[model samples]
Target chain A: MLQYSEKVLELFTNPKNVGTMDGDDPHVGTGVIGSPECGDVMQLQILVDDQGVIQDAKFKTFGCGSAIASSSLATEWLKGKTLDEAMAIQNVHLAEELELPPVKKHCSVLAEDAIKAAIEDFQKKLEGRTDKAELHSPRCCEKLNDCEGCGSHGE
Target chain B: MKLPIYMDYNATTPVDPRVFEAMKPWFCEDFGNAASRSHVFGWKAETAVAESRETIANLLGASPQEIVFTSGATESDNLAIKGICEMYAPDGGHIITCMTEHKAVLDTCKYLETKGYEVTYLKPDTEGRVSAQQVADEIREDTVLVTLMLANNETGAVHPIAEIGKVVREYRARLHSHLFFHTDATQGISKIPFNVNEMAVDLLSFSSHKMYGPKGIGALYVRRRDPRVRLAIQTHGGGHERNMRSGTLNTPSIVGFAKACELAAAEMENNVAKLRHLRDHLEQGILQNVDYVKRNGHKTERLCNTANLSFGYIEGESLMLKLRDIAVSSGSACTSASLEPSFVLRAMDVPDILAHSSLRFSLGCYNDLAEIDYVVEKVATAVRELRELSPLYDMALRDNTTGDTDWAQAD
Candidate 1:
């Protein structure tokens, strides 16, 4: 019943780089954001180099087709781009590229938020603020295996 | 089978060719108002109307005079609820209805609440069942009407309407109050056969489109013998429909509706058997192959055609998109285009995340084993694809494998 552009359908049907990277690697910073209740959950990972340029980007989302397409497009746009250029990528560009209706615009926003959160995680890793992992638990903020933040309640 | 095999029969059904054939003459050669009782054209039309009325009445196990046509289930529901309230609650009284009723019944009861009527909205169980005991507990001396749905549109869970009706009858006798029982049987009319007499029901409402009939026609069965129900006429035109409703008959649609009922009366058992088989095959296939899947209603007491499943960690809208070739609906597909989780599931206490991921596949008479197999394959593929991209699914897997993801210490 939704009017999906060919590009959106293409990316969603065959989304690229849709898996988790080395969450423990300092070069690989992962950002997980979005609410599962809203039908938008995006986890974007990026491998950054000393030059602050993204070498690779990957994403996995549990949301609508537009959200999957949006994050997939975000990953495609993230690689080889500097942090500043990646940050410059607005939700409007994603929405326009996907030809999404107004109702689906939030999906692009979630992608943008995932990008910002990943960049923040990458920067935090570079600065060696590992203690801040406490802020995000039950999710891979820093550690992928044993989550100290979620240590008490059995997940 | 055609692509996008329709599985939302609970929404609406295709008009059967037989029903269409029966209606075609009414639209052309037989185009005469039943109210025009002065000529041959009128007599012919009146005869056709009478024959159709008998057919519908026979299907409902009622008399021809008991059947009253309306625009659709919505109008029938409105007339029943408001008319009963007007006749019995002139000075004001209490009404009872459940939370998971179709909007036609719920909204009408809600409007009564605004007009100085005390309404008690009963909550169904987690399996989406409104128990007769719940209705009995809510009954009081002032309770004038009890309106509940026979089957939930979203969950397809069949409530014990007969028992609930008996409860209302008992309370009415005890209190000597004018408490009447009404049920919206739009989803369960022919799908699961029941007679108003055995149920002790005063009013029953159902739609034509839901049973392979035309879209704009429906009927309400009003009891005429035991206690005899009366309504304050909402329309006052030509005093048609025994002065209960006033409007020119929609001859074509009415004939179509009756033909559908006749066909259903003959073949419903076979269709239901086939539907149950197909539905169970689909449900079992998905549950066996997929993980974190939960059925959304009572297993045995549901419409044989419906299967509502919640796939954990998968967004419903996204799942529906991947299933474009299969005509199914997400739980929240009805209202608000923003993809909110189904309120029906929420009322049943389903977690919001699971509710967001739920899909409702309502099978119909036309669907066959081949279509069910195709649906199972496509749905399995779609769910697998979406879950592969779901970080929640990945995280849950990791947590389970590690036997650790306990974030309770943070609290």
Candidate 2:
């Protein structure tokens, strides 16, 4: 058996922010990374507020203790962070904090991927809403000053 | 029951107290070299070694002279395969083995391949069994050796050694050529019925640690009559083990091993009965309590003490983490350094996902019904908890509700 660190074991045994968020919720963006073929899969979801701050973070992972701990730590770190701050969370930080062995570095990478995927999904949803609002009512884009990057601000 | 219950007997078993007691005196008092012919201490050590050899031979239904002591099963396997291959290189250059064999056999066969020896790796069936016909058909005139394990270490799948032995014998007779049969019976020694004569095995390897004996000692039973099996000396020193294997014997461990064998011989029937009962209860309890679970290996042909289960949706390593107090093995890539699940399970055509989800619970003599009950409850609860934390489980459930159970097919 592998010797797991106390922190890794603790996080694995009592992972924070476990369970799922409504993937269909507009305020929620879900990121699913890794694959069962590789013997790990992580799903991380972030609920963003109107001001682009992460209101809540939840995750579910099917992998080793390291993988579970990585994602659990990711969720705990993701809550209350802006999308940019969430994106800045690298796998190295998780690896260092968890003191994962070299063989388990991929678990931290999976956690990082899950975070990026969640943020991208949230941005994509926001873009979709902006596009729909623009198509329906051009004035709605004006009312929402966040349409600068929507590529039709001047038009 | 202990807080951390040991259910990974297939990995290695704790030495029995009786066996330990039998070995205590040899470590210090009778520490004289068995090869010394002049001293009384030497005579005493030699006598003890001889007695242990006789006991071990009696258990295997072989002559005491046929047993060759080695460090452990790995060395025995190395000696059996490499020794046979090197000794009979001129006679034939072909060998046969299964894909699911332990690394000792498989890697040895691979080494032979590098030396231009042709090795036929027969594929096992879905249940992890290589049939006797498969062996017969693969038998070539130049097939010098056929090495198949008696039972797989991972799934506890028992191969039909006697039937395969019969096939090898018939083929050798038909071809009128030199052919030898070897079996790594490490996992099957005391757990199942095995006899060198009845199985028609020319060479057999087994370890003591696997059978509640001391570690670092094992034996190889080389057939001495009917068709005397000859092996090239792998280790050359002091001309020990009748020159087949040359090294000073591990007297204390050998004594412990023999005592373990004696105990196993006496208590095998009752022990097997109790182990089977406990193992069956554990298997059934987990199966009934947990959904999306499947048992690996042949239902009837597997070792009675081994239960290999694949709990879907939850990865094995994660589930194992939850059941911290329950010591078991998993076929998860994360558990291994190579990032691949058990090759034994893979050879049996288990899906990668299910292989990642596999857990092997091997019961032993020390385990009791109460321990079994605790393990079963713990496993059930752990699996349920892990599944709840598995996104795949959530997706699977959603897919089931929608009557589109093909979500797993996406991967």
Taking chain B only, the TM-score of every model is 0.96, 0.96
Top candidate, metric lDDT: 2
Query: Candidate 2 docking category?
Result: acceptable
Worst 10 residues of 2 chain B by lDDT: B402-411
Query: Candidate 2, residues A7-107: lDDT per residue as tens digits?
Result: 99999989999978877778898888877777778899999999999999999988889989999999999999998899999988999999987667777
TM values, all candidates: 0.93, 0.92
Tens digits of per-residue lDDT for model 1 on B1-411?
A: 888689999999999999998899988798999989799898988998899999999988899999999998999999999999899888778989988888888888878888999999899898999899999999988888999988988889999988998888888888998999999999998799888888889999999999999999999999998769998788789899999888999999999999999999999999999999999988887877776787899988999999999887788888888888888877742124534467789889887777888899999988988998888888888888888888888877877732322111100
Please provide TM-scores computed only on chain A for all of the candidate models, following their numbering.
0.83, 0.82
> Which residue pairs does candidate 1 place in steric collision?
A150-B406, A150-B407, A151-B406, A152-B409, A153-B406, A153-B408
Which residues of candidate 1, in runs, are more than 4 Å off? A131-155, B332-338, B401-411
Candidate 2 stretches greater than 4 Å from native: A129-155, B401-411
Per-residue error for B74 in candidate 1, Å, reads 0.7
Shift of residue B93 alpha carbon in model 1, Å:
1.9
Best-matching candidate per TM-score:
1
